[model samples]
Target: MDKRGSRRKSAARKDGASRAAADEPQSRVKFWMRRLVIWGGALAVLVALFVGLAVVFAARSMPGYYQLKATQTAQTIVVRARDGTEIVELGPSYGKWLTSDEIPQVMKDAMISVEDRRYYSHFGIDPYGLVRAVYTAATGDRRVSATSTITQQLARNVFLNNNRSLDRKLREAVLAMALEAKFSKEQILELYLNKVYFGGGAYGVDSASRKFFSHPATELSTAEAAIIAGLVKAPSRYSPTADVNAAVGRASVVLRLMKEQGRIPADATVDPSAVKLKEEAGQNSVRYFTDWALPQLDLLLPETFEPIEVWTTLDVGMQRAATASIKSNTPDGAQGALVSMDRDGAVLALIGGTDYIQTNYNRATDARRQPGSSWKLFVYLAALEAGYTPDDRVVDTPVSINGWSPRNSSGRNVGEIDLRTAFAYSINTVAAQLGNEVGFGTVASMARRFGITTEINTYPSMVLGTNEVRLIDMTRAFAAVSAGGNSVEPYGILKVETTDGDLLYEHERNTRSTQLVPDYVAAGITDLLQTAVATGTGRAADIGRPVAGKTGTTSSNKDGYFVGFSSGITTGVWMGRDDNVRVGGLQGGTAPARAFAAYMRYAVKDRPVEQFDTDLQLPEWQLEPDDEYMLGDPEDYYFIDEQGNLIEPGTSDAPREDPFGDEFDRTLEGDRPRQPVPGQRPPQQPQQPPQPQQPPRGVDGAPQAIGDDFLNEATGARRDQRP
Candidate 1:
């Protein structure tokens, strides 16, 4: 009985120990669970605090975000002729900027339809859109849709750097949510419109409008608005300026989206006629001008603090006319240039070549071609300074210069002719002879003074334009003559200003020199050149107005030129093959002169009738006895001045004695008669003794006694002496 009781007690102890061990494990599990719950609650509180702080801080920084969102850099350039007419209009250089008011309703609807149909109804993150995007991404081979809301796009544009990473995406999400809370849906839409790029260097709606249609943003039609809105997805691929068909196709997609979203009424139809899509014309032309103007801007306002608006002196109508005339007149293989400037040297119109689309070589301002007889004006000016009149006698005979025989174009001498006729006919022989007599160095000096920025050869042939010159410089030189010899510097921009209307700088028309030629002399030269258009070689340049010009046809007819001026404008035209090959049967009088006339007809159609200033008048001139005859060897003839007075022989000092005076006659009598030497072989006259002569032969080869007897008996000499 005692043994049974002990076994029972041991069993009781074992059962009690097993129960205590099981309870200890349960107690340890409860303690760990309680600690875990406390830690989890603390972590939840910290996460909530961090999110709240981030949201508050972002809200506080909203103003800075808005400011950053609003700021943009834009590059815009406009080119105008001297008359304030636009040649080209370039849109901004950077991303576009548009105001909310300027965004068309159709454009707004189109963006919402294609990008985010439920943008207004959704919060920053749309669960339904996310699900749809995921489903589309999973089912389709390509990701064709996006779930990013308008607020997200704004957030990306404003605050996020472009990094495709999870951290960035998370930050974008957070910022987007914060932005949605800070700004209204309408504000987000406005920011989106103002910040998008529409391609072709156009940034916002305003720039796009001007780029495609040459109109303002506020004036966009529904079709145009739709086209621009569609470009947001892929600017370069869908740009109307780059690919019209693609742009039109994208626009159609946007229209369908609009219909699907009910942004357009069910019955409303998109009219194909409303789009009227055509390839944008003149945009490339404007870009060409902008490229040209940028370098000029940098040079003109190197230290400018603010953005500048360059108001050029270009006449759009005249520029178009010039461009069209060059294209129409120039042959297919040939290139040409046309430059027109006001009398004050302001550039009115400039056509660089047949097509700027093909090449950017600005022939008008860059090319240096032989001016041919166009340079005779400089030679004549030198003669005028030396005292030669337009009517002074010269023989257009074959002349040899350093083994080079300078011959007239016709290869036949026209015999004795006046300087005016010689210049009108572009007689090379006569011009060379005159150049030799006047000294080529003097002619070159005068040319430089008149703004010819080309190297001139100091040879007799230089008088026939052996040097190359630019069209712009030629136009400017002629403009100086039109301005009564006042030196004029060519200018395009008159002022530059910011879009906000702040004047950054202004250009003043500056005259470099006024002493190049006497006003009266310039006027007289202009009068003589008028005959070239009215009744001479340049008659083809006549345009029912008072025109004065000169024609130049170079050797082999390789280059043709016509440079002219009206009362208030000067223009120069050049036609030639870039390879310097001879144009088949082309002449300055035929092609270039006609182009000038055609352009001037349209350019001056609406301009007022104005004559060259009559205030600058030349003094009365009388022909000298020596000036009336071309007797001596061609090289022996001296250059006469405007008064038909010979520069006193052997004296370098500017001649003070008039060649027309009685004393000037005594200076001519010592060596030879005022008549042509007999037999084309000059007969040598007997030299008189230093003392008074006894009996002498008359200038006409008649024998007579000396003093009063010889003077009284020389009947032919007395008659010839009459002025």
Candidate 2:
């Protein structure tokens, strides 16, 4: 019996051991599973904390919902020329801020069909679309669509820049949720449709409609609405302006989507080939002026949500004339720019290039080419301010400062001549001598006082205009001279006002009347400039009016310039290759001066002819053979060689190769051809290569002592106080 009981106990123990072995495995499994669940919960809590911190950090600086809504409303800037002609509309132009009732149902259905099919049902964010996008992305689907609802897109367009990043996405989502909470479904849809970008700088459905169809958004047909709706995906790529075929294709896809969603009938279809696009007017070069004016507008009203109307100083007639002059007169394979302003610094007309479509580079305001002899105005003005008059005698011999020597353009220096003759002839040696005597620092300071904003290196070559300068800044200086020595700040924007006619900013014309150059000094420069235009290098610029102007030509004929003033209008023109390569036979006195004359004829036709304000009667001087020791080599004085390389005293007639070979050729940028009309050259030199002419010496310069009567009659001011 004991043996049987022990065997039963062993059997029971074995059965229990087998059951425990199975249970042991199950217990280990349960312990590991419990640990995994706890760890996962902790990880999830940590992740939640991290995400919460991120959200708090991002939301801390966000604008309040009301402020955001107010600031995000679509605002457009309508830029008008001085005479109230519409130039261009900057920023996203909206149409009347249409209400829900004013919006067309066909447009609404098209937008909802393409952008967000469930836009009405979703609460700012679409979970189903998000899941579908994620699933498709996971499955490597190439056609993965954005998960953002219409509200989210609206939030992004209004409040955020279109940069793809997690932070931006988060901000977009949070803003979208807030927008949904604050605005009703209809209001959100209205804002979305009104503020969405539709390509070619158009912002709203209405702007897109008017821009593409020449009709209001309220008149959009099913086909036009589909075409516009399709632009939302890739506006620039599928804009009708970019590719009509692609736009039609995208519209077909949108129509298919609408049909599949039961928004349109299955049989509803439009023939793509039958579509008619609006014929837009040929865009003009006024965009350059508008472009330059917009930045100034920002300074006047940096932050505003209200629509603005900017009255600019641009004159449409003058602008057209300036463009035509630059195009017809600028040599083939060269580009030109022009800037015209009145004495009060109101920019009347500005052409940044001959054709803005061919190249958008604003040479008038942006390019910093060597001003050539136009810069001499500053040097001579500085000299005049330093107790030198236009009648003062200066030797026009070759000048060497340190190792740099400047020779005259004519390659021959006349004997001692008065400052007026030197200026009218653009005698380089006298200018170099004057700059050194007055000190280049003083010269540069004088330039600053006259509104030259570019960096002026006080080097010897600077006197020769080797330093680069912008055309607008140079033109402003000339304008100051025309304004009777008053300083000028070139302004294109005259006033800024809300569309409701409330003025925000108006330029004070009186503020810029402060005297920058002394009246006596201004008269002296004007006398010289008038002499220059009357019988000097700028003779081509004479328009049978009382004009004071100067011509400028750089080395290798790479740049040509003419800046002058007639009546109260000051205009500057520049022509050159973008690459700074030598333009064969190009000269400031030829193409540039002619262009200036051509434009000024039109610009000043209606304006009254006015004389310059002068108070100094300059005494004429004539140089007689005093047999002064001649300076410079006699042989080098005969003629200017082919290339402008220095003619060393005893060098052969064969042109000396430049030590800086090919360096001058690579000075400027760009590879595309300049705005040049083929088979066209300088108007005057259409057949013959331009020849250097000795500047006319016909003006009275006989050093005759000015009688008090003549001085009193010619200049109303006292002769003793004259510069």
Candidate 3:
């Protein structure tokens, strides 16, 4: 009886333990569920508070309504080349603003169908589209359609910034709501059409229509309206001026969308293959020229912001040629600028650099660099005006002014050379001598008279072109020499006119302009310039035509220049580094001269070939009898001994005896008597009496009288004298 009672008690204890274990697990699970519910509610409240604060912050930063309604773009400029071909359109262009009633119905329909399907139905934001976009984004799929309607786009374009952030989006949404409240749906559509950007610098529907189709917006057909509407999504991609085929395809997409929305007929279709785009010159390097000319327009029409057409003097063909030549010839790691103009100062082609897109600095008109030897134009002009002819004798020996010695580029000078030969070889000593003789002040004055508006230092080195002058100024000076001696102020803008054909200003010829250079002086300078190109330092610039230009290389080859003219067109080229670093082997005669030749060849291909007037009657010189300077190699004669005796050819110590034979030995003629040959000696000749030195012959070949100061004491050669 005791054993049975113990077993029943133990079984009851086990049953109690199992039931307790099961109930403990259920209790723990209930506790965790309660904690999860409490935390989730707290997180939901925090998110709501954060969103409320963000929306409040965005609403306060919105732009004013008055500012939104005002014109966004103040002005537009249409730059046209010389032949009426539009080069580029700068700044956003806003054409005639059309009201809701003036906008074509098809254009409105197309825009509405493509941009916002529920435009008339929605207040400002499309709730259905917004919901769809949010749902699609939540599902991890982007590429969702735009949720904002036409009102939203206009609000963003006119007032709000394009920052892709929550704050910007919220601000855009609030602005859209305000715009919809202030303007009706029709008015909103009109403002959107007129304010949105259609690429190629067009800002409004009318401007885009005129830019792409060359017609007004009201005249747009269904296809044209579709094309214009398609540009709203991606203006640069669909612009006809950029890519016509892509624009046509986009138009087809717009038409399909319009038909689906029941705005157009169900069977309505447009052929992409039949689309014809207006022909426009590709936006090219002409932008550099327009950039330079645009500022001048401001000076001519100050305080004016009206839409205007700028008629420039740029020759499209010549500009293209100049751009190509500069690009191909400019050395690596170097920059170049070019300016070409007619005799009357009409700028034909102005290239700021090799690639304008890479850099927009207008070196041609802006950079003031040392003109180098090309500045000798004034020094030589001063010489000619001082009554010194090209044939005047000047020795190319070493020269110094106040202890500053100028050396020739060759390091060896040819003594007793005429001015013509000295100028041809760019002999530095002669140029320095002439500049000093004529007075540096006179040279500077001559430079100013020829239109070098820069400050001219009357220092000795200034005559060698140390003064910094712009390429355009130097080219202008050359143009004065080429234009029959009248100075010209370089002008690029021919006229400024309103878009409606009202002329604001036109470049007028100054009939009362005085001659800066005398006719005879100009003709005389031409004689020297022609000889320089024919057989001198500027040989690389000769293009089988008469080209009279000068080459300039500054100290250490830092700057190289070639400026010349052909067929009444004067062009100047400059090559250098903006950082002022020296180029290894750059010289004016190398790249600059070649580039000049290349451009001139094409620029004057069709123009009539003309020659420079070089018929100036220059004074001639008769050679006075003197000991002839041997002009051949010393190796042609037998060697000499150390004791000053000639050695026979076959002797052992003959050929190797004297490295330089007696030909170069500097000794008096009578002191160093002539040696007889080893074989047979020629018969003796009678000595003639000394002849008196005759006066230099004038242009008429008559003996011209001169003063004692004009004669070189050593050579008895008459030097140039001031008149």
Candidate 4:
């Protein structure tokens, strides 16, 4: 019985132990559950702390982070020529920022329908839009349905780079909320419009309006407004200038959205044809002038200041005429440049090359080519300084210098010509000779003082333009002559302002003095250059105005140039190949002169007619007798060699008496010298027979005979007996 009872107890105890083991497993499960709960609660708290910190930091820092309020660097200033013709439109002023109130109602509604339908209701984050965005992203369908409020876009543009990151997203969201709190909805819209970048280097709506349409933002039409609104999302992709089709498509979307949102009547059929866009007549085509002016501005102002309004002297009328002339008259493969400047050194008009769109090479400011005979202006100046008058006779004769023989273009010697006629005819031989006689160094110095910075070769041939010169330099030099010999440096920007409309810097005309040529000498040269246009090779450039100019045709007829000036403005034109290839039959009188004439015809159409300031009195002594009639004695004039060596009268092969004289003495006999044979030296002249011996002569101190041998030795040769 006891054994049975003990076995029972053992069985009972085993059952109890089993029950305890089951309970222990249950307790372990309960403990694990409690620990999990604690851990989850702690993680939740940490996450909440992190999110709070991120929001606080972003709100406080993001607004000011990259909000760079660059000073107002440009102002809307009107550029006009001396004749008061509008030439160039300048920067934006009066705060280009536009609020929703400032924009057309249609534009505002279009923005809302396309950008964020629930923008007014969202508290900086749109859950519905987020879900849509996620679905699109996952499905690989690029449907941009995500809603970014105006505040968010401004935040992104101002403070964030375009990187897709969770941190950036969170910061953007937090900053959006912060901005909503700090600024009104209208203010946010204004900032967004002003801060967003438009295409074509434009940073704001104002720039876009002016650059694309040559109008103000306030003047945008429905089509124009729609196009501009469409650009806000993807400027480069929808820029009217870069991709007009894409812009039109995007604008259609905006118009459709506008209609759907009841901003426009649903029944209102918007004319698709009304969206026909015309690029501002001269937009994107004036790069040459801008390029020419920018560098000059850099030199005119401090490194930090870029002016808001640059009151340039560019005359839009003249520029248009010049461009039209080049387009209409210039042949294929022909390139050209035109520059016009006022007498005060202000640039009035400029066309750097034929096509700024097809090429970026600015011929007016960048190209350096030989000036050819156009360079004789400096030669004339040097001659005037050397007491040689334009009336002074210069003989166009066959001449050689260091083995180089310069000939007239006509290839016939024009005997006993005056300086004026020599210049008028562009006589190469006479020019080379004059350059040689007046000292090539002197001519080069005059060119340098007149504002030519390029190195000019000192060789006498340079007087006929063997050196290369830029149109800008030539224009400036001519302006100096127009300004009574005072050096005038070309300038573009008059002042620079900060983005906030504060004056940062200003430019004033600066002059330097050096004896380049006497004022009267420059005037005299100008007078002769005037005659070049009036009745010489430059006659093609005559515009019925008192014009002064010089034509240039380089070797091989490769380059053509015409640089001229009216009483108030100076212009320079050049035509040549960019590749440096010879252009077969082109001369200065063809394309370049025509271009100048065309530009001047339009430029001066409205101006009160004026003459060159002849009253700017030069000395009478500076005036040379007009070479129209040869009145001076041939002996009184001198001819210059290629080395600028002044050869005395009756020295060179130039005919002293008229070779075609009426005396008619063709049959007159003259002595002739023996000619040498082709292959052998003249048969050693037969040894002269011994001459008869002469008697001795006595010296002052003693009797001494001076024999013929002694005389021969003293003279280095025996006297010729045959007379």
Candidate 5:
């Protein structure tokens, strides 16, 4: 009985230990579950805090939606003629602002199709599109790329610059979301449509329709709408009037996208990007004037400028006449430029080229071409200022300055002519001799006094117009002469004001005019230039009334110019080949003079005929042997030589008696002459090149030297010459 009881106790103990082992595993599982719950909850709280901070920071960093008030009141620059006639309205002046409902459904469909097909389906941000953009960027595929949605583009156009950066992208995304929250879907679409720009100065869908189809946006066909929609990326590149083929090709891309997005029916297509037009389009005259005046805006207004009215000095009639005259008077394959200004320096009309839409290269303001004999006006003016007059006589014989001798257009000198006669004839030898006498420095100073701002090289050839100048600047100088010696600055904008009549800026009429050329000197030059128009090379520019002008023809007839003026107006005309090719000896007396005369006839017909202020007559002198002054060598100045080394006076490079000192100094006795050997052809000393012979020493024992003028080419100002 005792053995059986002991065996039962052993079995009971083993069963109890097995039960405890199973329970321990369950407890371990429960502890792990509790720990995981605590840690995951903590992580969730941290993530929530991070996102909240980012949202708060982003909201604080960006401007509020209410701050975008500029977009609503934005007006374009409306340029008007001096007579208050409208030439062009530059910005959003093409069409009236329209609501989203006023826009055609097809127009909206085309924009959404080409710009953002998934605009309605996504929230403010599209993650799938962003991911695809990133993938495309990574794969270096440039063709299939996505950047901004319509909302983001709206934000950029309204409030931000189109700068590419990670920070800007983040800000754009945040602002887009904010815009969506503040406005309804229809309102956002309205803003986008009203703010987008189409080429040819058309802004918004309504204006774009009128620009392309010459009708309201409410009546757009699928083809017309698609063509306008394709211009959002680059308005100038695909403007229909500028390039029809390009516009049609880009419209095809939009049509295909519209079909793919199911915005339009599969069969509905812009097969040919054709539309009905209501008017003859492409206003080149307005474009030419606006392009000339665009850069002046920054100096006239602040960078954060309000849209304002720019009342310019342009005359609509004169502008049209100028363009017509230039095109008609010029040759078939040549180009022309013209600028006209009143006596007070107001730009009455300006035409840079025959067709501005075809090319915006402004020849009047930007082209730097040689002025030829037209520059002789300054050389004569300088002589008059130095006591020489129109009656003064110069021997127009063969002349050369250094090695550059200029020949007359006639290729022969008319010997011994008065200053007025020489000027009227455009005699090269007489002009060069006078330039050498009075010095190039004085001539350059006179040129500057007349309002030339370009660098002036004072080489004697400069009197023959080796220096380059712009047509506008040359007109400004002539206006100064016409204004009785008052210094004039060429100006286009007469006044700038807000559309509501608030004065932003106005050109003040300061009666205190600065005098550049003296009245007497101006009168003298006017007398000579008047003779030029009456009986000289510029005779082609002669109007019925009294007129003064100068004709300019560059080497080989690459460029031709005729600048003429009357009592109240000064005009300049330039005709040339774009590639600088020589044309049929196209002298200034030919096409340029004809254009100048034609424009001037219309420019002055409205005003009464009057002579220039010629009350002040000047005394004349004669160039005599006893009193004649000549110029010395140019190597006296430390000018850069062909080797790029400074050729200075008293240096070995300059011809001198002895570059290095002799073996015996002045303090020691001079060496006796060496005797030659009796036989073998008398030993010879090395032949020394001829040295610069100084004039007979003066009474003060210094060598007498002729005076030569040197000028600084960088400043267009004159400097005193070394004796």
Candidate 6:
């Protein structure tokens, strides 16, 4: 071969060696490719075989799609106040069923936008979303859970226990596919909307819409729908009541997703800041009544777990006012409760605590505390029954009975005051003396008759309200007074009826309105209580109209109370520390009275004003005037002038003689005493006017009464009218 032939041959051999070197890796690649195909096929077979077995077994044992009936069976139990305002819901499931077409299209779009964008296109599961979820999680992304389609969630909610296990997931996936195949998209979406719980005890979009907006699902605004749609991811965390800002943030995300996915137009109107989620009444102050009514359900409806609507006697306006007044006026960390009822003892409003979310201990119905001078009502009522009159004078001096000495609130004794005056000042020493005078046992029996069920110790201190009693019972006692001595039991539920109008229970009108305390006894106590409000310690509770109640401040001020009632309702307010920590300078006339006044200001806004029937019939002894004060010197005459002013015979306007004796002479002199009024008896001669009162001293070692003595507590003084 030539030299050129030799170079070409060498190049060919080098090229052929390079080709062989490349063929070695290519041959090994084919070998491994064959092995990869064989193993990959086997693994795919195993996975398919496992999935097939899971599908077959899950299909055979698949839980029935019985959640529809379950949700239907466990329909929400709605509770309404007397005026038909929704107060709370009672039941495990609180959702209203809706048909496929009834659900709003916008609500459906919002859910699909956030939950599964491909909800309409996918069969059951979204492999793309699942893969994305896995990739993001594997890449240390925050999204770790598997993405569930609407149909999948419906399947899980219907038949699965929400366990995050392979077996459960397989079953959920199989059921999801089955549901998608079995039901229309509208049906699946309807089930999802009607079954998923939005927090605050709301299940389904309809109930959620109503719960948050006080309207039906069809009336949901776009913003509200977005907010509720976000709740599906984390019901508790996204609840507006739990974390409003976080819920609003979640709703923003949902809104953005909807806009981006074209479910809603970018230019579509959405009010992210305009969302107004109502506070859940079930979790608010109204919870006090709902919590109480739960136990009563067993007695109200034992035959069925089906939903029953309880029509409570709660006044929504009064309830809100009470909660607001307590929170605003009460000292921080101090607690308060209020219960208002009609004369018939129908609870108009009840506030268990300042805020139910903080502490649910219902002080109104459950808490027992000393009512200080409020107990004096029973003492005085008993005194009235013991033939003692409001005009019966009692010296408010320090007194000790059986080693128990009660001191006046002022720590200063005001001597020789009437029972009305003593009660007006809530004079402790005088009340103790009255209790001693009228037997403590008598006072206790009177209180029991008026609706106090608590065992009262017949000690002198009980006269100052040392015994503990519930606000409800106290309200009941006052209710008897407001009702003119008719005994009443405080009741919340007016009637309980099934949703289908079957009567479970009805507050019977024929229920006896028995007289526990005598009608006169109630009138007497009510008379004194009104004066207490008008001129004394309970003055803070005055609403510028006729109202009666008492102020009670326990020793060391551990509790304060102002229980007031008008002709229509009796309301009791309690303010104190939950732990019995003394509230410094706190008194029943301060916070409790102010709150009572504030509550009553609203409670009676729509009601007509009426006066308390004091029934002021003068005792027979006072029917006629005393001769010493009226008829003593008949030589002088008196008459009334045209302005209704009493004309004294000796005054400059009258003749300086006995007008009746010289009537003829005065008529001739043209200074005739005003012609005797036809309907009025001739005025008797007036005697020397009485002297200024002096505090009664040790007269016969007992409080002394002067002639024609009758004290008036209404003005915290003596009454010349002597009624």
Best by TM-score: 5
lDDT of 4 by residue, 506-594 (tens): 66666453445666677677777777887678889989888888999998888998888885788888888887788877888777888
**Candidate 3 segments whose C-alpha is farther than 4 A from its true place:** 1-68, 93-283, 617-723
User: Against the hidden true structure, what lDDT does model 4 obtain?
Assistant: 0.69
Question: Per-residue lDDT tens digits of candidate 2, residues 1-723?
Answer: 999999999999999999999999899999999999999999999986876665565456556545643554556789898989887887765555667899998889989998899988886789899999999999999999878889899888787766688998887877776676666888888878877889767777788888888988888888999999999998756878657778889999888888999888888766654667787655688888986887776567756668899999999999999989999999999999999998888899998887754556688999999989988998999998777866566777877899889999879988666778788889899999999999999889988988888888999989888888999999999999998888888888889999889989988866536887777888989988988988789989999889999999999999999999998999999999999999998988999999999999999999898887655633333221111111112232222246633343345755554322364234212211232112212112113223222222223743322223233433555445655
Candidate 1: segments with Cα more than 4 A from true spot: 1-74, 78-87, 91-294, 302-307, 511-513, 608-723
List the candidate numbers ranked by TM-score, top first.
Answer: 5, 2, 6, 3, 1, 4
lDDT at position 84, candidate 6 = 84
Q: What would the per-residue lDDT of candidate 1 be over residues 1-723, giving only the tens digit for each residue?
A: 889999999999999999999999898999898888899889999986886677667777766546856565444655555455555555554434555666777778877888788888886777798887788888884855777777777777666654577887777777777777888787778877776667666766777777777776677776677788888788766866555677788888888788777888766766533565435434333333344445677666644333445787777777778878988998769998888888777777777778764555677888899888888888888887677666556777778988878877777897776667777778888888878888999999989998988787787778988799998888888888887778888877778777688776688757355767877678667766776777678989999888888998889989999999885789999999888999986788888999999998987788787665523344545332332242323222233556755443334565443323575355454323423222122223444324322234557876432333223223335434554
- TM-scores, all candidates, are 0.53, 0.58, 0.54, 0.51, 0.59, 0.54
Q: What is the Å distance of residue 7 in model 1 from its true position?
A: 99
| Cα lDDT, all candidates | 0.72, 0.80, 0.79, 0.69, 0.76, 0.77
lDDT of 3 by residue, 1-723 (tens): 789989989888989989989999998998988888888888989976875565455446644444545758445888888888988778787788888888999999999888999988886888899999999999989778778789888877776655588987877777676666666787788778888899767888999889878888989888989999999888766777656778889999889999999989998766754755677754477877876787787668754547899889999999989989998988889999999998888899999887654455689988999888889989999998887766666778988899889999999987775667777778888899999999999999999998887888998988778999999999999998888778787888989888889899898886766798777788878777777777788889998888888889999999999888888999999999999899878888889999999999998898888888865643433232223222122223244466755454345645455332364254322323233212213223335433224434556786533313223422444344323
Quote the positional error of residue 700 for candidate 3 in Å.
35
> For candidate 4, what is the total of clashing residue pairs?
16
Q: What would the per-residue lDDT of candidate 6 be over residues 1-723, giving only the tens digit for each residue? A: 699999999999999999999999999999999999999999999997886675666556654445454544334678999998888876654556777788888899899998889988897899998999989988998956548888888877766655577987877888887776666788778878888868667778988888777889988778998999999998866777666777889999999999899888999878766787776544678888776765566665554646778898888888888888888878767898888888777888888888765456688888889998888888888788776655555677778888877777677986666667678778888788778888999989988887887778986778989899998888888878888878888777888888899988877652788876555667777778887887778889988788899999998999999898875978998989988999987899999999999989988888889977767454565454433344333333344455644454345755343323465444334421223222223334445664424323344565333223322321334455564
Please say which candidate is ahead in lDDT: 3 or 4.
3
* Candidate 5 per-residue C-alpha lDDT over 343-378 given as tens digits, one digit per residue, 9 for 90 to 100: 887888888888775665678888888888888888
Q: Higher-TM-score candidate among 2 and 4?
A: 2
- Residue clash pairs of candidate 2: 620-703, 621-701, 621-702, 621-703, 622-701, 622-702
Worst 10 residues of 5 by lDDT: 624-633
On lDDT, the candidate that comes out on top is 2
